[model samples]
Target: MAESTQQKLVCSRAKAKSDTGSSVTQSSSAPKRKASTALPLDMKVRCVSSIPVGPLVYTSRRMQGMIIEWDEFGSEQYIELAELQSMRNSSPAFFENNWILIDDEEVLHFLHADKYYGSAKSIDDLYGILKKHPNHIAQLVKTLPDHLKKTLSIVAYREYTAGRIDSIGVIKAVERATGLSILSN
Candidate 1:
């Protein structure tokens, strides 16, 4: 019975992976990344939701650079080649034909390109980028460095809710409170 149950669990996980075509998994033998202390779920959500996602890399004479310019909406966003794939996965509608940029003033702009430019196709694709790939949003967050911890702590402290409990982490709570995400955008 126990063997059968174990097999079932394995099958379920495999099925899940197959369904999404997501093969990325945290490396068991690899070193663990540091984790920040617990903050309000809403605060963490803000970190994810506040992220301004977009970028495409172009090659020059044996070099590559991604543009960091203002987008159609006027936000100071950025999009690198890899991150664009992730951005598309997270919000296919937002990133599909389009690109996002951020101006010096930190506003988001979105624009559609004439053709598809990257290979991200699902939410899992975006998650993989953020969770594992280079120059991804999560990578950017992790790159913010120790000095910013104080700034982050201050931001986290400020992002916490003063009202009733919502730490249980239901989708409804996310929708009802933050609306579109952690910071109301």
Candidate 2:
């Protein structure tokens, strides 16, 4: 009797799918997954490092360690907060020099405010900083206000005309710094 009832249900489902022109199929024994909740505000962070960081998993209020998904493989990993704290306390420069920030946008904005390198008082100073730290060109441009960008563009152009800098490097740097095209071809 139960078999007959199951056959009828399956037939009905097949009929329904045929009527709707649907190709969907699911085994009755297949496990259903629950929808995952969004991460808490504290857990979300913007990674500024050239190296990737994490989508950290919060365990519990009582736990001192947090789970970090470092790779695509499901390897269980845990890092102690105390150990990280100790490292930070031992050498603050490790964090600063590496330019790793696992914090919210506001904290990053605060850090960008004349902290790593002081603000340029003149266009020459700005150009000097950009030339010295080519790796930081993008980050420096991001931090600059519109007026500074304009000033920097003028300085870059002058340096290029004076043959003090390479045309390709100057053009690329100025475009990145000022958000404007120098030469098309």
Candidate 3:
């Protein structure tokens, strides 16, 4: 009786194994998943500023140079934009195309080839350029530094409460709050 019971157990085990194998085979033969047409999240910024405020390389209607040292503790990067106005008096000629160079190396380029220029025409122009790349927006939203992320969340919450929680609004809010313009047309 014990022998008969052992054989029955072995037969059941074999049957179970066969059932599992068939299921595995069926799953393997199932339709494969299709790749998404959406842009990837790893898209790089047209321009990138260093953490804790290192060097700033930029091109503006007023100023164009590499600022290696500044009052990082007191002033943020956008203050550099004001420098453009002061320096613009000296540089009267408009640079139709230019590059943000650092350490004598080109970092970012600005060109005005047509109506949709390579450089931003204004704040609205910069905003418009950013609207084209959804992936870039996702990257910024996902990988913003912790402090900035908290601030972004707050901005998003405020916007949500105000019924203005939109892509452009969120981007503009972050830009206004952070004073970091990492994207260009």
Candidate 4:
């Protein structure tokens, strides 16, 4: 009787092993998983100031600290997102003057310069305003004197005749006319 019981136990163990093996085979025949097609959340930014306050590397990767790169001395440091926010809050002017965020598509979104430039009564005042907020060039250009606007029109016409009219060229013309270094570059 004991021998018969032992044989029955062995047979049940074999049946269980076969069941597990069949499940393993089924799993092996299953389709493979597809690769991820998501974009990364990494970002790159530059300090647009004459005196860059932070690191020499201006990139931030996912799960990594943002690198702040200073242009003046070519120094760089890795800082957390919270720390970067702290720096910006602590020195708003420095942050705004230096690190204006450009979108991933390289588009610049600036605040309306009306309130800032409206107070200027003369070209000198406009120059001073631009000296403080260089990012306001586009909106402020509309508020320029009629003669200066005509000059800019002439410059734009020249560019149009040349088969290419980029905003940078117009801005350069503005700098030449106004004698203000609106762009850090």
Off by over 4 Å in 4: 1-69, 72-79, 99-172, 176-185
Please say which candidate is ahead in TM-score: 1 or 3. Answer: 3
Enumerate residue pairs that collide in model 2.
none
Question: Which residue pairs of candidate 4 clash?
Answer: 48-98, 55-68, 55-69, 55-70, 55-76, 56-69, 56-75, 56-76, 57-69
> Any runs in candidate 2 off by more than 4 Å, and if so which?
1-118
In model 4, state the lDDT of residue 100.
33
TM-score of each model, in listed order:
0.17, 0.33, 0.21, 0.25
lDDT digits (tens) for residues 1-185 of candidate 4: 99999999999999999999999998888785443233322323322222223333444433257455555422233344344444444544433333232122211212121122223333333334334333565566656544344333444444445655445655565565455554565
Please give, for residues 1-185, the per-residue lDDT of candidate 1 as tens digits: 99999999999999998765644443344685444333322211100121223433222222245333343222333333334434444455443332332121111112122123232222223223323322233333343323222223223323345332233233223223222334343
lDDT of 3 by residue, 38-132 (tens): 33223221321222234433344443454433333112233232343332333422222211211111111111112212333222333333444
Kindly report which residue stretches of model 3 are placed more than 4 angstroms away from their true locations once superposed. Answer: 1-138, 166-185
Ranking of all predicted structures according to TM-score, beginning with the best and ending with the worst: 2, 4, 3, 1
Question: Number of the top candidate by lDDT?
Answer: 2
- Per-residue lDDT of 8-126 in model 2, one digit per residue for the tens? 99999999878666434333346754333333323333332212233323233333563333341112333343433343455444244432333333333333322432244333446
* Per-candidate local distance difference test: 0.33, 0.47, 0.38, 0.43
**Model 4 lDDT at residue 148:** 44
lDDT of 4 at 56: 32
